[model samples]
Target: MKYNNFRKAVSSLTSQRSDSSLPVVALLTGLAVGAVIGVLFAPERGADIRTKISDKAKDLSDAAKDKLQAVKNKFHSEGHELADLKDEVVDKVKSKARAAEELKDEVIEDAKSKAKDLADDVKAAANEVKNS
Candidate 1:
């Protein structure tokens, strides 16, 4: 039961789409709103304040773009890593299955040989009793 659940969890993790960037975007938006509000309330000349606000907005835009790009890069890297992990898992399972098959064959052959030996022993005893 636990193993089935574990397999389900692993498969779900691999299949589910990660929306991890949503939180990052939301945090950046909150920061932008706070910064704008702080800038608006500051006592300063209107023109200078406007310039500062514009610069800050531009800076925030650039930062957001950089972060989004970084997130995309990391997502792609992790996808590759997952693919490699899946391949490794498949290879390991195949190897284990092959090993099990070989073991089964060995056990079957050993049982057959033992059965033959037992049969020969029985036949010899029967012949000895008949002769006596």
Candidate 2:
């Protein structure tokens, strides 16, 4: 149950994060593109340009890691909420199933009682006819 809830929470978070992150992602992409263009056009030595590119790459990587960790923590917290919801649903289903089973048993017993009474009435009528 815990595992299922956690999975569902993670899936839900993934979808939501993707939707909300679109603008951030686009902004980061634009910044990276612009940085690269500026670097290429600058009249710097080849070695200096390479060093700047490496530094930019490391910065982007670190930022991505931070965002990922934050998302992971948020989903982990929400997993408990999902698990509670799942438990409530399972309990309601079990209660309904028990009620249905009880109703079925009552119906069967009532039918049996009625059938026995009917048989007794028929036998009494036949005995009267025999005596007459």
Candidate 3:
């Protein structure tokens, strides 16, 4: 019945032009029109429907607000934890950097001491050769 009529309608629209999308457009239009008709013919009074719609909207709004608040709270708590973690990481990095700097200074001093010793040995060798 209704399906048959819908099929017939589509066939009729398609028969007018095989290369066109008139049938699809007409089908969508028909669905929209049907929805409007159905809503208009609903058994509930207009005022009652309005109230129901408003109540549903309010409920959804409240749920959304609650969810938003929960997210905000979680974000705030996480932010504090992140700050603490950042401080700890910064402290560790600073400690490591200080250690690295100290090691660099020690290596430089050791190299200078070795070079001076080598120079002194060379001078002593030259003096011995001159005496001989």
Best by lDDT: 3
Rank by TM-score, highest first.
Answer: 1, 3, 2
Tens digits of per-residue lDDT for model 1, 1-132? 966885676556545635775565556656876877777897887899889879999999999999999999999999999999999999999999999999999999999999999999999999999999
Better of 1 and 2 by lDDT: 2
Sort by lDDT, top down from the best: 3, 2, 1
Clashing pairs in 3: none
TM-score of 3: 0.59
What are the Cα lDDT values of the candidates? Answer: 0.85, 0.86, 0.90
For candidate 2, write residues 64-91 as lDDT tens digits: 9999999999999899889999999999
Better of 2 and 3 by TM-score: 3
Candidate 2: clashing pairs of residues: none
Give the best candidate by TM-score: 1
Model 2: lDDT of residue 71: 97
Find the number of clashing residue pairs for candidate 2: 0
Q: After superposition, how far is residue 63 of candidate 2 from its true place, in Å?
A: 4.7
Against the true structure, candidate 2 reaches a TM-score of: 0.51
What lDDT score goes with residue 55 in model 2? 100
Off by over 4 Å in 2: 1-63
